[model samples]
Target chain A: MTTKDISRPVCILGLGLIGGSLLRDLHAAGHTVFGYNRSRSGARSAVTEGFDVSAELIPTLERAAEEDALIVLAVPMTAVEELLDDINTHAPTCGFTDVVSVKTAVYDAVKARGMQDRYVGSHPMAGTTESGWGASMTGLFKRAVWVITFDHLMDAEKVSAHWTGIWKDVCQMAAAVGSEVVPARVGPHDAAAARVSHLPHLLAETAAIVGDNGGALSLSLAASSFRDVTRVAGTEPGLVRAMCEGNADALLTALDEALAILQETRDHLATTPPSVEQLADNGYRSRLRYEARTGHGRSQESVSPMLTSSRPVLRMHPGQPNWDKQLIHAETLGARIEVF
Target chain B: MTTKDISRPVCILGLGLIGGSLLRDLHAAGHTVFGYNRSRSGARSAVTEGFDVSAELIPTLERAAEEDALIVLAVPMTAVEELLDDINTHAPTCGFTDVVSVKTAVYDAVKARGMQDRYVGSHPMAGTTESGWGASMTGLFKRAVWVITFDHLMDAEKVSAHWTGIWKDVCQMAAAVGSEVVPARVGPHDAAAARVSHLPHLLAETAAIVGDNGGALSLSLAASSFRDVTRVAGTEPGLVRAMCEGNADALLTALDEALAILQETRDHLATTPPSVEQLADNGYRSRLRYEARTGHGRSQESVSPMLTSSRPVLRMHPGQPNWDKQLIHAETLGARIEVF
Candidate 1:
C-alpha cells in the first residue's frame, strides 16, 4: 500500500489520560486527529487545549468514517464493551484498536461483535498517578509498548507493517515523554502487570490500613518509604479497583505466592533459633541474591516458580570465578542451580 | 555539668552513611568531631574526606577518657553489643549514645553494663540507597529526624536542653539535605520504622525476585514502578540484612500485617463480585488517604497509627462541612478529597 493509502485520520474515544495524550501526540505528528469524550466538559477542555474535539461519538465517527482511518478506544477496560458496541454501530469503515490494560475479554467481545478481522489489541504501558484530559500530555506514548495482539485471521505481513508504522509514530512520542514500548503476548502481559502494576496498588491499600488503624499521628511518622510504597494507592481509587477486579485471577495467584514467601520468612524468623548474625546473614544472602540477579538483567523466566521447578538450568554467577568454579561456589553457598 | 565543663571531643564510631553525614554536620555546626571505623579503608577515606580519624578504638577512647566527651555509636545494630563491651571497659568516663535502629535492645545492653545514666539511645531516620564514604554527603542529615531516647536516670531537663541544641544543629542539617525531623519514643520509632523502613526492603526484595525469574527481557520491561518499589534493595546488602535482623520482631509484625491485608484484597477480588468501578474507587480513596497524611509539618501525635486506628482524621476548614458528608459525596462521585 502507498503512504497515502496507509495513513488516515485517527479517532480517539474518551479523551482522558490515554486518549488525550494519544490525540496530542498524533496531532503533533501531523496526523489529522479527532477526539470524542462522553463528558461534554472534557470534550470542551480538549478543544480548548487545541485538540479537534467532537461533542458526540457518532458524529465524530461519521466524519472520519472514510479515509481508511484508525479508531483508538482509549478508555478503561470496564468502558471497553460499551464503547465497542457503540463503535460497531457507528465506527468508520476502517481498522479499530484500544489502549486498555487487559486484552482477553475485550478481544472476545470484539470477536463476538464480528469486528475481529479489523481490530487490534494494544496496551501502552505508560501512565501516571493522575487522570483525565487535563493530565494528558502530547508525548505520553513515546517509546511505550504499543502491543498489537494478532490472531490467525489477521494478515501477518499487513498487520505487522501497519503496526510498525504506528509504533514508529508512537515510539517517538513515548521517548519524548520518558516512556518505553515493550511488546508481549496477552497472558504474559496480564501476569507481568499483575505483579508490577497491580501488586503495588494492593500493597498501598494495605499500607493505608495502617493509617486507618493508627490515627493521623501514626500516619504522620510515615516517611519516604511509606510514601513511595503507597504512592500507587494514592492514584485513582476507581482505576485501582478496576484493575484488581479486572485481573482478579492472576492477582490472586500472585498474592498467594507472595504471601507464601512472606509467611515462610516470618516462620523462619519465629522458629529458627539462629544467632542475630546468622539471621542477618540469611536475609543478607537472600537479598544479595535477589539484587545481583536483578542488576544483571535477569528476566521472569529464570526466576518464576513454575519454570524453576520444571527446568533446572538457572544458575547464579559468583563474583570472581570461571563457570565451573562458580557452579561449585554456588553449590557451596547452598543455591539451587539446575543445568538445563 | 555546665556546658563549659563538657570539653571532651565527640567520638563518632563508623564513618559510613549516617556516621559520616553526622560528622560533617556536627563539624560544620562547630563541634569537634572524631571518627573511628573498623574498616581501615573507611577510616582513611574519612580522614581524606576531612574527618579526624582514629585508627584504634580503645586507644582513641583512652585518649578522650580524661575529658567529659560524648561517644556516638553509629554502626549497625549487630555490632552494638561488641561496641558497648569495648565502651564499658575503656570509656567509662565519657557519656555515650548510639544511632541504632532498634532502641530497646541497645537500651537494655547499656543498662546491663551499668552505664544507663551516661547513655542515651538515638536513631536518625535519614538515608539513601548509597552507602560507604563516597555516598556520604555533608547535607545528608539536614532536616532528618534525630530521635534521642532518654530514660529515668538521665535528667529530663538537662537532656532535653542538650537535645534541643543537638536538634537545632541536626534539624538544620536535615533541612539542608532535604529530609524531615520526626521525634518519637523508642517503641513508636521502631514500629514506624518497621512499617516505613523495614517493609520497603522486603517489598523491594520481592520485586527483585521477578527479575531473578524473568532474566534480561523481563528485567528490561521492569518499569519505574518496579524500580521505585525495589530501590531500597539496592542499598548495602549487609546493612539491610543487619536492620532486618536487629528489628526482626517489629518487622515481622509489620510484614505479617501487610501480607494479611494484601491477601484480603486478593481474596476480595477473587470472591467478591464487585463492579470494576468500585474497585477503582476503593484504590483511589485509599491512595488519597495516604497522600493527605504524608509530608512534613504534621505532628507525630497527629499521624500516629497507634493512636488513630488506621482512620486518619480529615482536617477541614471552618466553613467546610463534616468529613462524613464529604466522604459520602466522594464515594458517590468516585472522587477523593486529598488536601495535603
Candidate 2:
C-alpha cells in the first residue's frame, strides 16, 4: 500500500552531512523525523539542536517501522552491508532507501537480503569541500540532482506504480526544498557516476598530488584553473577512500578512458601540435547545453548547429568584392559566418 | 638612463585580448599609449573605441622608437619570431617585452636578434574563455600573476636597474588594477607554467574529449565538477594549440609526472582498496595552502599540524570514565580529534 499522507514519519539513520541535511529539511517540512547516529555525542548534539534523535539503531528501526516510516540509511559505504543485515532482522517490512554515491553494490546487497521489493537507492549530487553534520544545512540539496534507482523485483507495471507512489512523495519533498529528482536503473547510474563524479574526484586528487610534488615554486604559480580542478581533493581521507572503494570497478573504467585521452593529447603535443578544434567544440557545446539545462544561460536559440558538425566555415574572402555587407547581413540572420 | 618621466609613451603591437586590455589600463593610467594591429578591422575598432591605433606596423614602431617608448609584442607565439626580426631591423634601441605563455623560445629569439640588452619576456597568468579585442576589458589582469623574465646579457646591477625602472612602471600599472608582478628566469618560468597552466589545459581537453566519447548518457551526468575542470578546454583551438606546442618539452615533463601519479593511484585502487590517506592528506593540505595564498580562506592560525604527521589519534575509549569533557575541551582548543 502507498503512503496516504505526505506528513508521515521519516527516519534517518546516520547523521552525517547528507543525513543531517535530510533530517533538517524533512523536519522543517513538518514531517516527524527520527535521527539515529552511532555516536552518543552526535545524537545528543542533534537533540540539543531540537532534532529527535537516538543513539541505538535496532530500537530506532523498530519504532520507525511501527510508524510505517521511510528509513534512509545514510552511513558510509563500508557500513552499508552491516546496516542492511540489521534492518533485515529488525524492520524487514519498512520502506527502505539510501543516499550512497555508488548504487550497484548497495542494491545488490539489498536484493541479497530479499528486500528489493521495497527498497530504492539514491544519491544527491551536491556537496562542498567540507563534510559531517556540522557543515550540513536544510538547503544543501537545493537545485541539485537527486538520482533514484531500484531493482526489478515485480512486473513492469506494478513496479512502476509502486515506485511512482513513493517517488512522487520524494519528488514533492525534494521540490518543496528546491531540488530535482531523476530516475535511472542501477547499472546506468553507476556507470554515469564513474564518468562524472568518481573520475573528477580522482582528477582532483591527482592534480593536488602533482602540484605538491612540484614544490613551492609550482604551488606559487598555480592559479584558478588548477585550484578549480583540484577543489574536491580537499575532502576528508576516510570519506574519499570510502567513496572511491565503493565505486572501484566503475572508477577504474572511467580512469582508463581519461588516461587514454591524456596519452593521446601528450603524444600529439610531443610530435606536432594537436588539432584541438573537436575538443574545443565539444567543450563549448557541453557547457552551453549544461547552462541551458540548469537555467543559468540565456534562452536557447532555435536551429543551433550540431556540436559534431564541421560545416558553415567562417573566413575572409577579400577577393569577393561587395560581399562584406552581405556577410554582415548573413551574420544578422544567424548564419554564424565571419568575414573580413 | 631610466626614463625621466613615468608617463613616457608605451606602444603595443597587437590588438588581441591581452594587448587591448593592457592598452585600456595603461591609457587610463595617463600614459601616452600607441596601439597597432595587423588586421585593419582590429585597428579600426580600437580607433572607434577612442584609442590611438594604427594598422601600419613599421611607421608606428618608428614613431614610438623616436619617443624611446617601451614596446610590447603581444602577438601569437607563431608571430613572435617575425615581429622580433622586424623590431631588430627597424627599431633596435627601444625597450621591448612580449606577453607570451612560454618564455624560453621568445627569450632565445630576442637574444638571437642582438636585442638581449633591451628585451624582457613577460607572461600574465590570467585570461577568460573568450578571445580577441571584443572580449577585452580593463582589469582583466586584476589579482592575476604577471611573470617577467630576461636573457641576462648585461652586468647584473645595470641590467637590474634598467629593468627595475621599467618593471616598476609595469608593476604600478598592474597594481593600479590589482595584479602582482613576479620576476623569474626563463627556464624556471617555463617549467612552472607547465605544471600550473599548460598541464591543466591538457586536463581540460582530456576531460572534454572523454565526456564527448561517452555518448549522450555520460554527457547528461557530466555536471559541475566536469564543467569546472573542463572550462579551459573551450578556448579557441588555435590559441590552445599554440600554447601547448610552445611549451612542449616542459609539458611533456609535467604530463609524465601526472601519469605516474595516476598510475600509482590506479594500482593502489586495484589492490585491496589501497590506503588513500597520503593522497587525501596531500590534497587537503594543497587546497588549504592555495586558499590561504589567494586570500579566500580565513586568517592564519598558529601551529597547525602537518598533513603528513600521523598523530593525535582520534578514537573513543570505552574504558575511560569522565573523558567526555576532556574530548569536548580538546575540541575547543582547536584539536582535530574526533571521538565516538
Candidate 3:
C-alpha cells in the first residue's frame, strides 16, 4: 500500500496560494494533481493555466475516492469544517492531510468526525507578502521546510498503526515538491507555530499600529527597520485572524512571554542612562545560532532550516514495534521522516 | 555666510559606516570631504580607496579649524563625548554637526559643552544590517530622509538666529548626498526614534529570542514573517544597544504602549476561541495608510516617506521673523525645508 511514487494523485481542495502552489509544484514534479477550487473563477483560471481543476466539490471528491488519492484540504481554517463534511460524505476512504498554518484545530475537527486515524498535517513555511492563486508558482516550496504533524488524540497505538500508507504518500508529495519534511506532534506544532508564526503576525500588526501612531514626523523618518518589522502587518487581515485565533493558548503564551521580555528591557531603560547589553547580546547570539543552523546568511530571502544528515528519518514498516514512541521522539527532535 | 553651495570643505570624524559612506558620497558628488578615523587601519583603507582621510585626530581638527570646515561626528554614541572634548580643544570655532542615531544625546552632550549653537543634528534614516568602514557605500543615503533637528535647550531665539549658517550647510550636504531634509525638535525626534527605530530593534531582538526559545523544532518551521520581523536583531550588538539605550525614556514609553496593545489582544484571545478582527484590521489599515504616504509598495526595499509637493518648504533668512515657530510648524507637518 505504501509507495515512493508521489504520483499517487493529489486532490487539492482549494486553489489559493498554498494549494495552488502545491498543485503547480506537484505538476512540475510529474504528479497527477486534481485542483478543486470552490469558486468557479478560480477553477476557470486554473483550467486556463492548463491545470486539472474542478469547480464541483462532489465530483472532485468522487474522483478522488475512485483513485484513492490523497485529499489535501488547503482552504481557510474557518472553511475547513464544511470541506471536511463534504469529503466525509464522498471520499472518506481517501485519507486526508491539510496545509493549514495551525494543526490543533484541524486535528480536533478530524477527531470530532472520528477520522483522526486517516489524517496527517502539513505546515509549509514559505510565502511572500503577496497571496492568492495569482501569487502561486512552481518554485514556491523549493527547499522549504514542510513540517509533518500527526493527531494523537485517538488511541496512540491505533492511530500509529493506521498511519502508514497515507503518511508515506504525504512525505513523497512533500519531497517531490522540493521540501524537507520535519516530523512534529500536533500540540507542540501548534505551540511552536504560535510562538514563531502566529505570534509574529500579531506583533507585526501591533508594531505597525504603534508606528502609525508615532505621527507624521515620526513616519517621515521611518526606514528599513520599521518597514521590515511591520511587513507582515500588510498581509490579508482575514488570513491573519484565522491562524492567530485558531491557536489561542499558544499564541497567548507567546504574547505574554514577549511582553515580559519587553517590560524587563523597559525597566532597565528607566535608569538615567540605560544599558540593554543583556537583551542585545542574547538576541545577537541567537541570530548567529539560527544562521549557523540554517546555512543561509538571511540577508533577504528567508527559508526554513533543513534537518542535518546525521539525524535519522523514520521509514515505516508494517506492524512496526514502538511506532508511537518513534513518532513522538522524532517530532520532539525536529527530525525528518520517510513513512514508507 | 549663507550660501546654496555644499562645497565647503568637510572634516568627518570616525570613518565607520555612516561617516565612511558620507565621505564617499560627498566625494562622488564633487565635494572635498576629509575623513578622520581613530583607527589607523580604517583610515589607511580609506586612503587606499583614494579618499582624503587622516589617522591623526588633532592634525585633522587643526586643519578643519584653519579651513573653518564643517566637522561631522560619525562615531558611536559612547565615543561622541571624547571626540567632542577633542573638538572643543582643537576645532572649537569650526561649527559642527553629527550623523548620530539619537539627536537628544548629542544635543545634550553639545549643550553641556557650551557648543549647542554650533551643532546642527542630522539623522539620515537609512542603513542595512551591516556596519563598519568596509560595509560603507556611496548611495546609502540615496532618497533617504535626513532629519534636521536643533538643540533648543538654549534660548529659542538665540538657537534659531544662530542656526542658519551651520544649518544651511548641513542641508546642502544632505541634499548633495541625495537626501530630503525634514526638520524636527530634539525631544520629539528622540521620542519618534524610540517608536520607529529603537523600539523595533528591541522588538526584533525579543522576537528573535522568542523564536530561539521555541526550541529547534519551532525554528525549523520559521519562515519569511519571522525573518523579516527579526532582521534588525541581527544588527551589530553595540549599535543596537547604543540606539535602544541612548533613547531610554522614549523607548520605555514606546515599549509600554506596545505592551498595552499586545495585552489587549491577548485578553481577547482568552475567549473560547479568539476573534482578533480588531487588531488585524487596524494594523492592515495602518500599513495601507503608511504605504499610501510613503509611496513605496514596501514589498522589499524600504525608503523613507517623502513630503508631497503640496507642503510648504521652510526657508530661513537672516533676521527672519518667527524662525523658531516656523521650524516647529514645518516639523509638525512633516514638511521639507530649503535653507540658504
lDDT for position A72 in model 2? 87
Worst-scoring 10-residue span by lDDT in model 1 chain A: A305-314
Per-residue lDDT of candidate 3, residues A204-223 (tens digit): 89888888898887777778
Please provide, for model 1 over A1-340, each residue's C-alpha lDDT reduced to its tens digit, 9 standing for 90 to 100: 1123225567788888988888787676666778799888988887787778987877877765755567788888888888777777776355777788776667778868876656767677677778998788866655343443444123332333444344333323333333433334456556766776666566556665654444443454555666666566556667777766777777676667667666666776665451233333343344345434334323443465232211112243212234335433332232323221
Please tell me which predicted candidate would have the highest lDDT against the true structure.
3
lDDT of 2 by residue, B142-224 (tens): 75766655336222333544554554455444555455555556777788788877787777766666565555445545556
Rank list by DockQ: 3, 2, 1
**Candidate 3 regions with alpha-carbon error over 4 angstroms:** A1-4, A152-154, A158-162, A298-326, A337-340, B1-4, B151-163, B298-325, B338-340
Per-residue lDDT tens digits of candidate 2, residues A138-252? 8887756666563442223335344444544554455555555555566777777777777777777777766656655566566777777777776777787777778888778
lDDT of 3 by residue, B1-340 (tens): 2223864688899888889999998888778789788888998999999998889989999999998899899998889999999999998887788888988888888879888777888899989888889889989988778898854523554554345677878888897888778888888888888888888888888888888898877777777788789888899999998888788878888888898988888789898757799999999998876766565665423443553423345676423667667777878877778766
Superior by TM-score: candidate 2 or candidate 3: 3
Worst 10 residues of 3 chain A by lDDT: A300-309
Sorted into a CAPRI-style docking class, model 1 comes out as: incorrect
Higher-scoring candidate on lDDT, 1 or 3 = 3
Candidate 1 overall Cα lDDT vs. reference?
0.59
Q: Which lDDT tens digits does candidate 1 get at residues B200-222?
A: 66765665554334433334344
